[model samples]
Target: MKAVLFGIFLLAAGNASASCDLVSAPCSTDSSGNTYIREQNLGGGYNTYRNGDLYSQTHQQLNGTYRETYSSGGYRTYYSDPNRGATYQGDPKGMAGR
Candidate 1:
């Protein structure tokens, strides 16, 4: 599985240290001693929260595609059919298709 660093530097936000291993503790602390916790949602999805604030969330769509949304209003979608990915800033006009 790929490592998803839901930390301060996810988009070069800052220089906070974070380690995420899916099969491990599913938790990490940044440089400021803030702990981020990953918990599975009630249904089929997971959310990463920091200090009680929602940081990011990932959910699988009905089409089997995975979409991740961030607290900053950004979003990313992983398409398995085309084996590609796309990221958008705060709006659809800032889409960076890949």
Candidate 2:
């Protein structure tokens, strides 16, 4: 029982470390040493920058839906309800999934 509990704790810790809460932190660094920064727009929404370049822009609608547009031309829409979200792939300029 003790070993099982320890394993569960370890798994949770690993997951927590791997995930980033963008609202709490202005920036986050991945394991690959790439840094992502979140800058709030004056009008609304936010722009995310990766390695000093535009990565994506997220805008929230009045209905609370989130639309994220990537610099690579890909875009995703997140709905408040589960399974209602949509993602569209765009040209990555020869890069796989960016």
Candidate 3:
């Protein structure tokens, strides 16, 4: 019974390390001097954030494709590899029409 309890404790501790919480927001000012808040995911591949007027998103797939979305209804997708430069897809104008 004691060994079983110890095993359970170790399993719980290891699972906790897989999850994370944001310590603070990432903020910045644009060229027009508009201040905004930004948040990033500590995990490299995928992250999501909510700012004052925009919702930002990012994802990096295992196949080396990166995607980002903006609240303005626009999204940019890119593919990165050693043999080629970053290729962009989707509507550069905005996703409002879609």
| Residue-pair clashes per candidate | 0, 0, 1
Compose the digit string of candidate 3's lDDT tens values, residues 5-82.
999999887654323222244343334444344444577543333223445566676777766666666676656421
Question: What TM-score would candidate 3 get against the native?
Answer: 0.39
Question: Which residue pairs collide, candidate 3?
Answer: 26-38
What is the Cα-based lDDT of residue 69 in candidate 1? Answer: 80
TM per candidate comes to 0.48, 0.53, 0.39
Q: Which regions of candidate 2 deviate over 4 angstroms?
A: 1-25, 80-98
- The CA lDDT at 84 in model 2 is 22
Give the lDDT of residue 64 in candidate 2: 87
Model 3: worst 10 consecutive residues (lDDT sum): 82-91
* TM-score pick, better of 2 and 3: 2
Q: How many pairs of residues collide in model 3?
A: 1
lDDT (10s digit) by residue, model 1, range 1-98: 23456543464543333334332535655656655666678976768776557877778889888777878887777664111223321222223462
Candidate with the greatest lDDT versus the true structure: 2
Candidate 2 lDDT at 88 equals: 19
